[model samples]
Target: MTLVLKPLAEQVMVITGASSGIGLVAAKLAAARGAKVVLVARNDASLTEAVEAIRAAGGDAISAVADVGDIAAVRAAAAKAVGHYGRIDTWVNDAGSAIYAKLVDTPLDEHQRLFQTNYFGVVHGALTAIPYLRDTGGAIITVGSIASDLPSPILSAYAASKHAVKGFVDALRMELTADAVPIAITLIKPAGIDTPIAQHAANHVDGEALIPAPVYDPALVAEAILDAAEHVRRDITVGGAGRLQVLLGTHFPALLDRLAGVMIPAMSDKTRPKTESTTLFEPEQRGQERSGVQPGRKTSVYTAAERHPIALRSIALAGIAGATLLAFRRSRTRK
Candidate 1:
């Protein structure tokens, strides 16, 4: 089937986890770009508020309250999108929850719960959206994390769930290709973006749960998601530091592990009091963009790399050739 996706202005987008964080930003951005949007989340109140905000901005939007973790709920939500908008051109699995605890410290049930939302939720979204997307060849964008590439000390369960998400996305993409399916599957791995996730994460540590420095604005991630919806790429890392971390973990796994073991503990704030507020079992009502975490850096190298890969590769090759030539000349001079 020769599938050509519709333009954003003519497409209908369904974004899960649309009540807050990067998901909310992506919904707003997509609606602003002229796409009719369907917002899905577990919280009815927050979903209504998000829809209202989008409508207030003169964008077309509707809300469906569904927990992505539940297959039936996800399918119902997909049905609602199709019923209301007629069809879904883009489906984003951005609904996820995390836990801040050592693997041993985290309860088995808690770990299961986290995976239910992070991994199974994505699976449900993909499975439910695939049939609708298969006919027209649309996009499925899953929000993964840098943890998918490199495991973190305090967030082992969360990291593992992200790994599962990556695995599922990879295998599904391969299967779709083999079957000649026209759907575009994309995995977006973000570094610690400023999102309410940190505040809502279930923490089993001595201090308050927090995402470390070098945080990025959630808008950066939302932009990447929207871009993937329009121009489907297989994988995209959000922050420059995240790209660096992936590269290091890929090439120097042992060294990266050793460094992370020490850095993770040192970077965390141990003095802050632990909070009881968490969205592990239920959704929180705080509806806002930007996690309130001040970004440590203002630039995203990953975005730059993605936007100008050829130019960056050329520069890198030139540098390597120049160094090689200089080394040869010095060797001859020494001889």
Candidate 2:
């Protein structure tokens, strides 16, 4: 069998959501680690800024503005990446959107929107990259929220989207392997990082705000994402909070689910509103709409992000759910 190890220096990585948050930071780190980068995002301004920063730091990079939710745009960006780098070594589906509303209160349109961005967006990336990855023997990495494993009433749609991503990515991984393709896929699940996601959250029910615990910097999650992609791990869960959730979910699912079901509601009842409509992704990325709710000030991690919150419940749910998974694995190992 011919061996094709990734060329760390000459390799190219296509990162969606590169205009901000994990996508932005992943591009920075990959370039630093010696990969030429192809950046994709909906915001042209942020894409320009991100590419300039990468070049300034002596990294090879190119930018393409696209809405991953829109299949055509995503396909066009993928084609551009192959043209720019001549070969793509990695693709990271890091684009995401989150809006809050009780499942019933949130309208169908909003849920559909989230589905387009979170679930179908990943599907689009997969469709675009699979053929290229097959040819290049490369990889695909998708961003999934802790919501996939944990349940939350208010962010039900957001969670559903992530849940769908996991199934999609996992199945894709199996198919690639079974077909004897030298391709790897990873799922990145990080606790809240202080990004603009929350401020941009659309209101579904009442204008309730989600006050997060202290969150970490977006750069933190970015590092973990690179780790997963480079190492070809199954899933990488970051933060003390996220670990806890995975643990409980693994071992004590019923208990963790009950507890989480109670906590989010109690928190939402006391939470305040932003008093305005905001966008999570930068304006250039989210159709040139100015992003409000300043960069998160979260600087701490309490089992989850400790410095700030993306959504009040995004981080905590991971810990609660993770625990059950952990516990179950422990029991199986002991057996």
Candidate 3:
């Protein structure tokens, strides 16, 4: 069955993790485009600030203070959105947390807590949004990571949770399709976007935690999520470099395994001392998009190409033809 989603102007969007990072960015963007936004997060102050900011910008927004990991809380958030806006046309599962530690070094309880926020939070958000989305053929966009495709050295638990997220999202998509559900499900696999997540992650290492190099602006991810809201996309990767890394990991697992020695240490910011700034068990009050670690790239050619595959193919075909013509002329001249 074909799924038709309403435009952002006419939709009511419920976004988890909307107090900061990509979720907040998306909520602001959606509100600007005339969608009524319901921002959900554990930090009431941040959520209220975000909602007010949107309102001050002449956009419609409301705050829902709830943890995405709790199914009942998630359900209540959904009900609140429906109660306020009359319907939920889109739901974005963007709440996530990470740990900067190896599997052996990280505590088992830490791993479970990370899963509660990352994996099961997605589970709760998706299940809670399904019935609402089914009503009017809306979209559910989950913010996963490139870690869903490639495993990281120090972030083993975070990677595992992302892997689980991808698995569950894929299976749920298939099941929904088989049952002829009109809800569009999209998995957004972002590379290291310049978000506060790295700084907020539970640090098991001695050094300050950091997202790997080739970090992208969180706006790119927000764009992808908003695009998936109006359009049906199975999955999207934000950065070209991260996409290349995933490809390398897929094709040369042994090579990535061998590179772990260098990769493990590089994932940390050695220049700074480690601080106890973690939101693994509880929420932090800080709300910002970029982590200010490094400047993030403003655009991604690969992501644009992925969004417009036909145009990408046309460019490829033209390049091939031009190369073939040049070769023919060179051969003729040589003869």
The 0-to-1 C-alpha lDDT of every candidate, in the order given, reads: 0.86, 0.72, 0.90
Per-model TM-score versus the true fold: 0.94, 0.79, 0.95
> Candidate 1 residues 1-335, lDDT tens each?
55566788999999999998889999999999999999999889888989999999999999999988899999998899889889999999999887888788899998999999999999999999999988678999999998898878888899899999999999999999999999999999888888788777888877767776568888788888888888768888888887888788899989977887676675346787766788778886566666665553556865766855687688789989999999999999999
Backbone clashes for every candidate come to 0, 51, 0
lDDT-superior candidate, 1 or 2: 1
Residues 177-259, model 3: lDDT tens digits: 99899999999999989888888898988778888888899999998998899889999999999999999999999999999
Write one digit per residue (lDDT tens) for candidate 2, span 163-279.
Answer: 899899889888877788888788877665666666557755444555343345666677666665555566766566655666777788888767866656642433555435644
Per-residue lDDT for 19 in model 1?
90
Index of the highest-lDDT prediction: 3
Question: What lDDT score is found at residue 139 in candidate 3?
Answer: 92
Model 1 vs. true fold: TM: 0.94
Show pairs that collide, candidate 3. none
Off by over 4 Å in 3: 316-335
Q: What lDDT score is found at residue 195 in candidate 2?
A: 64
